[model samples]
Target: MRITRIETFLVPPRWLFVRIETDNGIVGWGEPVVEGRSETVRTAVEQLAELLLGKDPLRIEDHWQVMTKGSFYRGGPILASAVSGLDQALWDIAGKHLGVPVHQLLGGHVRDRIRMYGWVGGDEPAEIADSICAQLDVGLTAVKMNASGRMHPIGSVGEIDGVVERVAAARDVLGPHRDVAVDFHGRFTLANARRVAPLLEPLRPFFIEEPVVPENSHLIGQLTRSTSIPVATGERLYSRQEFLPVLQAGIAVAQPDLSHAGGITEVRKIASLAEIFDVQLAPHCPLGPLALAACLQVGFATPNYLIQEQSIGIHYNQGAEVLDYVLDKTPLKFVNGHIERLTGPGLGIEIDEQAVRSADKNGHAWRSPLWRHDDGSYAEW
Candidate 1:
């Protein structure tokens, strides 16, 4: 069916949702946001709509190649995120039209249930213990926490010890049974990453995320060689080309965001590329329902899939939660630390259209927290 109209809704708690409608009255939904840059991504999606209007929604592959490469200046977070949401909507429409799930179209299910992890707030030892306990109460077997917040570029030895102590506290609470993943958040420099890696190795964190920013990805190989802990990154990477260097860096896990990294179309290919290196695929999804649904679709079909990240009670969801705008929470209900395979057609979850449209009326302009050191030098958050 021909695409009739494409609509975008800027929802609260920093999210942008895209809806694609066809001549046959079938509609598909997707989440296309870059955390704080929802309005910018929405504008990018609006511009990309010119290329997709009146085109057949079923031609997913062709449209993907064009939307991603047609523009000479392409493949940034904004452009790729716009294409990501559109590609998700197209896949959602394709699955619904065929009366099957996206994973079924991708190949068949490899696992009956996909393991998921929750994000715990980065606070003091007591607060960290409380948050980890809370997540465990809800049946989460694995939880991730930020190692440190607003770290200095060259932190002192005491600060390094504090960072390790924070993680060690979580390990103590988890009791060597449940998994604990530590997020470096790209705040640590190469030297800091190296210094902390050996200390954290003793605790055996699930993985160290973004030890440094993507710009310093060449150093990832050195860091990976130094530490036995797995290295995972790529929420900012936008395409297969961007992922090639990181995979070649000997990283053990590749974390591509379904909403940021060209959606299912490119992420599925990214998973294949990582598979060649024997790396695991753990999607970085901390957004709305449609994005998580799209991530699960890929996780179900991908062979090297490791785990999925969902923002159910993540600190980012202030006024809005994951299930608030979703009509079918059954597809997302966590049980025994894993989400059972969704049998519904199209991304396997239904979006509440009325809630979305109403939220868009008073859309939000959310921005990431900007931090600074004591001397006013800028610091990563």
Candidate 2:
């Protein structure tokens, strides 16, 4: 069957969803968002759709290569994310056509259910402890939290103490068996990363995410060698080439977002590359149902998979929830801190077309907030 139509929706709480239709009536959904820049990615997908119309829906690899590299200027967040959503849809169609899940198409499942982790939010010690307990009540075995709210570039001793205290609080709630990971969100500098990574070492966090930004990945080896705590990154690294250096540098985990890092086609390759270095795959998914579904497909097939991150009750969701437009929440139901493998074909979840069409009419213009340092210098958001 040939691809017939490609439609995009900018829904509430900062999300962009893409729907691909084929002549034989099978359709696939994808999340091709760059977090805040939904409209720009939408335009990029629209431009790419011109070349995709009337093409074979099953030519996934060929379509991926052409959509990503066919353009003169290619492979940034916008183009990569646009290509990512389409790639997901293409894979979904292929899986449905073959009457198997996407993981089976990748190869086959290496294990049963993959372990998942949730996010808990709060600043104060009591609040943070309460949030962790709340997640545990829902059967999550592990939880992640921001190391600190807003950080100074060269932070004071008080800031450093606050980071340690928050982690200690989380560890206290998690006890010895449960896990907690801290997301630095690329706010820490190399020196600060060195200081904090070691301090959190005693607490034994599952991992420290984005100790430094992807741009400063050259410093990763130094940071990794310095801290006993496992260093996890790559949420911002979009290509296999980008992941190579850090992998060689001894990063403990690779957290590529399926939606931003060239979708299933490229992330599988990145996972293979990371596997050679003995690194684990903990996909960075903090978006919608389709993105989480895509991450699950990869996790099920990949042998080096560690844990999965979903956006179920993440603070980012405002008016809409993660399962808001999903017709069947059974596929994503979390139990005992793990989501069972999806048995349905394609991305393995059904999208509510009516809800999507309705949300699209009142589409959102969502953007991440900009933060500034006390000196008025720009800070990473």
Candidate 3:
């Protein structure tokens, strides 16, 4: 079927959804957003649509190559995220046309159920033990928390002790069975990242995320060698070429976001590349329903898929929750901390068009906070 039209909606709580309409009455949904830059990504998707209209929606790979390389400049948050949403829609259409799930087309599923993790702490963490307990009460066996908030390049031992205390509290609440992962959120410099990386080992975190930013790969290599805990990053990385250096640098887990990393077409390629290096997949998805659905499609098909991130009750989505705009919220239910395989065609979940249209006008221009130190120095948030 030929793609007839592309539509976008800036939905509530900072999400942008794209819907691609085809001639055969089959439509596909995608979430193409960069957390705070929803409008910019929407414009990028609109420009990319110039190349996709009237093209056969089923030629996913050809379209992907063209959408990516057709432009002289490509592969950043805006361009890749735009391509990512459109690619998800194309794959969704392809799966529906064949009357099979996306994973079935991608060599079928390797596992019956995929494990999922939830977020506990917000940008600035507080009541972490209570948050951990809340997630555990909801049947999540694993939860992730930000390691610290607005840390200085060189901080005091008291600052270091606070991070240690947060993880330690989460560990105590989760006990030995449940896993806890700490995210440094790329706020720490190489020196602090190296010094604090191994300290979390005693707490037995599942993995430490973005110990240092992607720019500091050499430091990551050093930190990985110093600690036994698995080092996971790549949420900010936009392409496979960007992922190669970090993979070669020796990360134990690759956390590509389906909404940002060129969607199913490129993330599948990224997953394959990571497999070659014995790396695991823990897709970074903290967006709305469409993004989570896209990640599940890839997670189900990928062999090395470790755990999927979900924003079911994340802090940022205060008024608009993940299930609000979804027509079939059942696919997101967790059973003993794992999501059972999706059996429906395409992304295996339906979108509530009525709700989407209604919420479109209520969309917020959501932006993350910029923090400053006590002395008015800029701090990472």
In model 3, the worst 10-residue window by lDDT is 122-131
Per model, state how many residue pairs clash. Answer: 0, 0, 0
- TM-score for all models, in order of appearance: 0.99, 0.99, 0.98
Candidate 2 deviation (Cα RMSD):
0.9
Model 3, residue pairs in steric clash: none
TM-score of model 3 (CA atoms):
0.98
State the lDDT of candidate 3 residue by residue for 250-306, as single tens digits: 899999999999999999999999999999999999899889989999989999999
lDDT of 1 by residue, 37-80 (tens): 99999999999899999999999999999998997787889998
The root-mean-square deviation over C-alpha atoms between each candidate and the true structure, in angstroms, is 0.7, 0.9, 1.3
Off by over 4 Å in 2: none
lDDT for 268 (candidate 2): 95
Q: How close to the true structure is residue 176 of candidate 2, measured as C-alpha lDDT?
A: 99
Per-residue lDDT, model 1, residue 80, is: 89
